[model samples]
Target: DVKVTQSSRYLVKRTGEKVFLECVQDMDHENMFWYRQDPGLGLRLIYFSYDVKMKEKGDIPEGYSVSREKKERFSLILESASTNQTSMYLCASTSGTATANTGELFFGEGSRLTVL
Candidate 1:
């Protein structure tokens, strides 16, 4: 089974401090993504890496960045945590298949962040 594990399930940060959230997938998926979930706003993509050492900016890349040094691991970095940045962070991964039925990605439990 495809499994995605997040480094933290909860986080609390002071405003302006940088934060790192890690994610690892057991499957050798080619696509890894970082996103933040907010009430009524749904999920917004932060960043995505298609392969090792390759990355792309998603819809909302401001105040955030990502790293993919290895095939199995992806990390999300918050440049400066703020009250507005406090939300549920999610990590997901998808296989390298080009089939249209690749379906949705597998998600982590989520990292809930609260900024003070």
Candidate 2:
């Protein structure tokens, strides 16, 4: 069984503060992704890393960045937090490239961020 664990399930930060969201995958998945979930917008990809020490900007990468130092861990960094950035962040991982890199994604519970 595969499991994705988020370091923090909930977080509250003030504007202009630096926020770090960490994720870990038990399975040796080659790919990891960070996504932000909002009411109407659905899941918007923030960033993704296909390999360690490599990252690719996703749909919404304006106020976000990612780091993949090791194969099992990926971290999302918010350089300057803002109210507009408050949302539920999800971390997902896939074992391998199953049909165009769209394998069965195992997701974490989610980290709900509220920027005040």
Judging by lDDT against the true structure, name the best candidate: 2
Query: How far does residue 55 in candidate 2 sit from its true spot (Å)?
Result: 0.4
Q: For model 2, how does the per-residue alpha-carbon lDDT over 1-116 read when each residue is reduced to its tens digit? A: 66899999999999999999999999999999999999999999999998999999999999998999999999999999999999999999987653565678889999999999
Model 1, TM vs. native? 0.93
Give the worst 10-residue stretch by lDDT in candidate 1.
Answer: 95-104
* Per-residue error (Å), model 2, residue 57: 0.7
TM-score of each: 0.93, 0.95
Residue 37 Cα positional deviation in candidate 2, in Å, after optimal superposition: 0.2
Clashing pairs in 1: none
Q: What's the residue-level lDDT of 94 in candidate 1?
A: 91
What are the Cα lDDT values of the candidates?
0.92, 0.94
How many residue pairs in model 2 have overlapping backbones?
A: 0
For model 1, residues 1-116, the per-residue Cα lDDT tens digits are 66899999999999999999999999889899999999999999989988999999999999998899999999999888889998999999998745668557999999999999
Q: What are the RMSDs of all candidates, in order?
A: 1.4, 1.3
